[model samples]
Target: MPHPAAEHSAQETVPQAAPPPAPLPAPAPSLYDPPELNPGAWQRAGRRLLAKTIAEFAYEEILVPVRRPTTASSPVTDAPVHRAAAHENPSDPYAEYTLALDAPGERGAPREPGAPTGGGTLSGPGTPSVHGAPDRHGGATGSVGTGALPSRDGAGEPRDRAERPHLSFRARRSAYGHWEVEPDSLLLVEDGAAPAPFTDPLGFLTRARTVLGLDGATLGHLVRELSATLAADARLEHTGLPGSALAELDYAHLEGHQTGHPWIVLNKGRMGFSASDAARWAPEGRTEARLPWIAVRSALATYRGVPGLDTAEQLYARELDAPVRESFDAALRDRGLEPTAYLYLPVHPWQWDGTVLPLFAASVAAQDIVPLPSDGDHRLPQQSIRTFLNVSRPERHTVKLPLSILNTLVWRGLPTRRTVAAPAVTAWVHGLRDADPFLSEECRVVLLGEVASVAVEHPLYDGLDEVPYQYKELLGAIWREPLGSRLDAGERARTLASLIHVDPAGRAFVAELVRRSGLAPEVWLRRLFSALLPPLLRFLYRYGTVFSPHGENAIVVFDEQDVPVRLAVKDFVDDVNLSAQALPEHEGMPEDVRRVLLTESPDFLPQFIHSGLFVGVFRYLAPLFREQLGVDDAVFWSLVRSEVLTHQARFPELKERYELFDLLTPRIDRLCLNRNRLHLDGYRDRSERPHAAVHGTVPNPLHAL
Candidate 1:
């Protein structure tokens, strides 16, 4: 058979009309400008991210920060006191400590230096609760530099003898003992550490390398990832959209504004993406590009769909209108191909040029894969880089294709096995939701099912167990039901990630929602907790299943009043896990389904909700609520605890299951995401995907309540 390109080239004819005037090249969008790449924004983002890294790492015991003694004479300065010179000799407990405090108009400045005149106790676990130390009255006291301290010099000068204030407290003890604090870099000083301001991530990591126990190789790679993360953060800062303005954006537009994964310091590190690629594909870029469709020969590709879409043609008909569908079919026929013999799949433009065209040259040359022109609506990238929402047709299914780009931990590709079984998996999950009265009638949680899918495995790599998993996952696409289709009148949907988004001016999207809803802060939060907690808790205890209800996977449905009404979840096949223990519920599950889904122990199941929802999101939002709404950290957690308790009470029959999948454990395993990148697997290809490293246990803030 003649090659498809050759057939098309033979039929091509020159334009009959006069050539149009030569047009100037279009200017590149600002998102392609290396994320502003300025010292001010980059360093600021780095320090903030470093602060999170220190807190979470220390919380996980990957790095332990010791407390330095503070006394009446030498009060905690508004800067980091270099204890390296003092503690350097290991044997020497005290040496001359140089305090690199924040100067006027810098972080950590202008306040009382000493502890309050009273007994001091440490705040309970997880990152230091210093930011909302309860006693701080929602003021910025507990963070690295939240405490008020008199300003020294911006150049790290010592305080004047005449301006020094009196020390109030004689002593205070905690896990991090009476540590003298500093500005810029959190109190991350250790023996032999050089005194410095929070300038750059690489510098901070270098100084604390010994303390962090990071090898040089790990540090180098981590710096690169952090550099990418900092650049993205700078871009977000440069957008200058306040939370209020951000809230006004459409769902797809709002996705572009979100700072991803609150806990992951290097969340935006699109390692394989060049600046140009990032501009065209990164969610932050907000570029709308039409994707071309490819017709893969049936012998080389496989597709599955729900009962309604029993055939690939049926799925295509529903996605594309009559005119567009005909155009796509005609394009294939013009290349001397029968449309019935091929499966149409939309391909990410970047994936085509970067991976498919070059890697699948044999298939293209053999005319097995025919590239068709983009005939449908333009789509916008979502927070998950590979997924795109149809902007022209809001009701159309969102398309997820295998991009083969290294992002977060794994390559952003759809696994062959998962892609093949996606529709079945969705059917099973949606079946449970539809059957359960609580889920179907009361909560009305929407499961945006992966209704159709196509998988074209690499002929060579598919059979190799030794090959990197990315290779096996490189060529597949999933079509998920759009959130817009499931919504009722006056309802809108937003990703859970948006709730915690705080803009450049430190205004939170949730706060804006609360203001718009005209509900009191505490009341509004209670409504949110009420909407999210019950349905998630019930799914675990009742069905022996759990979804990775992370920020991106979970969607919050809101009413016209801007109050959260219900939850909608997507990304099912890859993230949903079943219980390993035999449950009556699983007895009826299909054999093919059992082979593909992951089974986790009941103990580990709650982590999907705990680590994914609580620690992953609420941990960040708690402080924001404290600052914005005066809902004390303790009160905020109390509200969450109340919701969980209320749900447990409603389901008396699932008490045993609740106990088995305990959400109220005293210490839950701390899933260390960044640690996996830094130490466990440092930019090396692995046969399997990487997961969060459980370093140790952190105190579950919800345990007591």
Candidate 2:
């Protein structure tokens, strides 16, 4: 309205020194706070970006090699690494640029020991191909045609992009804020291009590293986001995948997230990874690096034809000690995503060394993953990881060892079931030395007594060795303790005998098994029982019927030939008779003593007496079979039947006894089924107990199975 002061003052005051403007303090500055998000939200965002990259790559399988001399029409897109197979062109060193997965001297090797291709049509040598195929058709057996694979996709549609591989991206983020692909054939880089191996990935990584300048903390955050998205995709494919894969996956992403690091991994074949151009060499790269004997054994075993197991554990130790899924589960529980979380390991070069054994075998065998063995050293190869794993959930990581030794240290054996038992098991080392004499060098029987004793004495009271006498006594007091149920049989007899004897081989076998089972949970336990125990018992006693299904006896362990770690318990010399048997069962044993304190059960005697001794001892072990200890299950089973079980058919004395073997069963259910049926007269009341009915008929427990 410009009324009062304006009307009078405006006319004369326009020159009034701008009304002596009042001095004002500046408003508080924002201090540049970035956008707020939930804790670790940045990681989720990074995962989304990674997922997008993968999704896009999956759509474009037409590989555009940076230097493979491919037509420009299919020029390299966003794809990373590329290479041809070893046998593609012998004339060109770059031909063996693809992955090589054959073992040092196996069938698919450049020169396997007994190659039909190496030998010629009988008299001379076979013709060798330039690089496509080594002429091994020595037998002139002629080329066996494999015909093209019937496309899994619909009959007419172009090979679906979905069916193609997720384009490989071996990336490295550098200290200089650039990302670069570990290009295939380091020697094949375009002559004019600068740092071709690192150029492919530089675009995306450089922009972020230079502009965003995230710290390790920021890197971790973004990587996690990428990991989550991939895991979600895997969840649709497999359920066994664990959430822990995220740690590996995210870290793997970071490896490629940069391009210009001082050090870069260069592939040679698939057997080795060199820290070439590294700012700092790896710990294992130090002079005189030595792995444990068991680890060496495990590495060789990993060389067997098995995947993830072949190199996953080894690489995990070498490059990244990815945390177990359980650890992440606990973290996520504290955060919110329960159960559905997943984790993955990045496929870096460390994964190519001994760790890639099985993968190498599979790739070559199936013509899926190719081999590119080096012409000179024959080690250090480029590597590739399948975008997806079949197991839906990630494995639980609980080896409890440093990343450097995790694979060999995988927790196995019954020892790992509880914490208290660990100390007792540890304490047994002293006892191992004590009982070394009588056991087979492989049994590890010498150390068991000590282990058991320590378990009983353990401050935590771990009961591996304890008899639970309180419970036993309680049952003892409550019932007439069936003559065979309370005391008279050798329960821990095999263990006892092993403890007393000092056979180094026997002791070693058992010791390794127990230790590994504690870590691996007898994953092969039930099968080990079927393979070893039955044959041994069959060879022991021939006249009486007997069975050795004692709870502690049935066991399993690792059988890595390079480094075997068996899991089952052998025989028991350190046995105590828990109960006496009826006169009927012990009628005609060789040992003069009528009331013999034996291990396992009376039912097992007949098989041993009939053919076990004659066949197993006389025919099998006496001759010494080698494949029995190797990894082939068929080989294992063949030995079991042909060497041991077959002997039963040859022995005429066992026909009738064999019938008894068919009817016998362990009394595992007696406690639950007969608890009230048992009674004791004139005895103090104790924990209520059960009884056995001599006349009752029992159905075969295995029927449910």
Candidate 3:
């Protein structure tokens, strides 16, 4: 079969004359109504989000729910009983918990003197009341659960049914003190009233605002973000395919099916995107778009690339065809400007019209920034809304552009300093892998380098001190090495995030892959760990470096039979971090790379893997595996712990490094993702991007193993 790029190029070469412009279509009688917004879809999305809200909030110690004694009877009379585990072992991780909501304008029940005021006292068996003291058996263990609930009204009498609303559900505390709440098990009971399924995320948030410590302003913005997220979730639910079908998709198409960041409750809170914008540009939109190019004057634009792609011309030569280059030059020459005086880069259509035209009007008027027609390659947005994969030419570089919308946590924009230093950072990280025998030969880990970048500085914003970080990151483009060109023959790649994805029918993508591989679930899981952990472990212990191997940033490569084989990682400049203490491995690092990569102390350096992969990705994956594949959560965690130990044993000579960058510590700092948005950042614009909130420590499962 002819290559797709060849077909595209041949078609472009034979193009004759431009067609005449056509009139705009007539307006429809009614506005488009999205099918995904039906009540059924919303309720499903809401129930999931509500469960996530409760789980994440409880995990972060923001809303501590009191543990309730589990009885054989269902919490809700009509609702089906859901148990995390089938057997009722005394040491079983699952437990029942309840959170009470006071009536509007009424204060919570009075607390005993010296007891905590908000929730209550932690007095439940096997539930952790204090930080870093989780049960060794992979459950919350403590005799004293301080979180006590109020069953009575403020007038010291039992409140009416409607006046006393409380939520009850069964949840299991997994590794890293993670909470996995059974969404179907959640119920809202009002004293004398019959219990009903709790499916309203907004109502839950509104009712528990005081308990959650959310101020009015933050609560208002949070509600908006949550609603936006639910809408996106509904769309995914409406269109989601079964795992069997998803397993057959290519990397680019598979990305559209993924539910966003697993750890974030409001994962799709694209603050600046309208419904139309989302349909046109969101990853789940699954529409291919040709991004229009822009020419920024040399004075304001800076280009950076690795050794072979040292010049803008070199990058353009590889990224744009001759015809596209000539057309760009013709556009500049027609305006009486030299093409050499400008740097050409693609701009997202929405960003071009919404952000650039409005904010950088002065530059456009002065012809310092001139818009050019698209290079004519159709690209699909990946999980990261701002990144695009060129479907027209799969071998071409994937482009990451600045998008001034808030999602997950920060504005999805490339920072000026990091954008300019991307190539340098990539080169340094790639150099480390290339020089190491294990990474280069044995493991064969693929580092998808950000080979080139064009940083366009906003004239006024660049000069201003303490300007909003989003303004400083207004316009930039990073060209990353494509995944298609890096994989071995018969090897396919999927984002690590996809493994945790559960199809609307409750089938896990991992289970599908495992079944197709013809391997026992445990064997497939071991293969997954073996493929993922070694490279990451080497980077932290041997090289004193770590990449945030979070779901979105890491890609797992599978062989023809669907067995995981190797790892591919991207987003070098933003997600990579290094050790604060100087090591021999740092000797080859360039000054620019050193300045760009953030450094942490040796003690905290491992958090990138501990939090990013173990907690961020695997925390959720473990539960899904247990539920769908019947792999015990403890066994799943043990597999992960064994991988780390195996890697450590393989590098006995670097035993000292292992101690410095310890992964088997008794406790690890709890990095809170949802808490950052709810309590810390809360839609507020700051000069710098916000970091994850560090709450109390969580017991490390690896230590127990």
Ranking by TM-score: 3, 1, 2
Can you give the lDDT of residue 696 in candidate 1? 38
Clashes of each: 10, 134, 13
lDDT of 3 by residue, 429-483 (tens): 8888998999999999999999899998888998887888889988989999999
Give per-model TM-scores. 0.80, 0.20, 0.88
lDDT by residue (83-138, candidate 2, tens digit) is: 22211111222211111111112212222211222111111132111101122112
Model 1 C-alpha lDDT per residue in residues 674-697, reported as the tens digit of each score: 666755577889898876665434
TM-score pick, better of 1 and 3: 3
lDDT of 3 at 409: 90
lDDT for model 1, please: 0.70
lDDT of each: 0.70, 0.24, 0.82
Against the true structure, candidate 3 reaches a TM-score of: 0.88
Candidate 2 matches the true fold with a TM-score of 0.20
What TM-score quantifies how close candidate 1 is to the native fold?
Answer: 0.80
Looking at model 1, residue 516 earns an lDDT score of 95
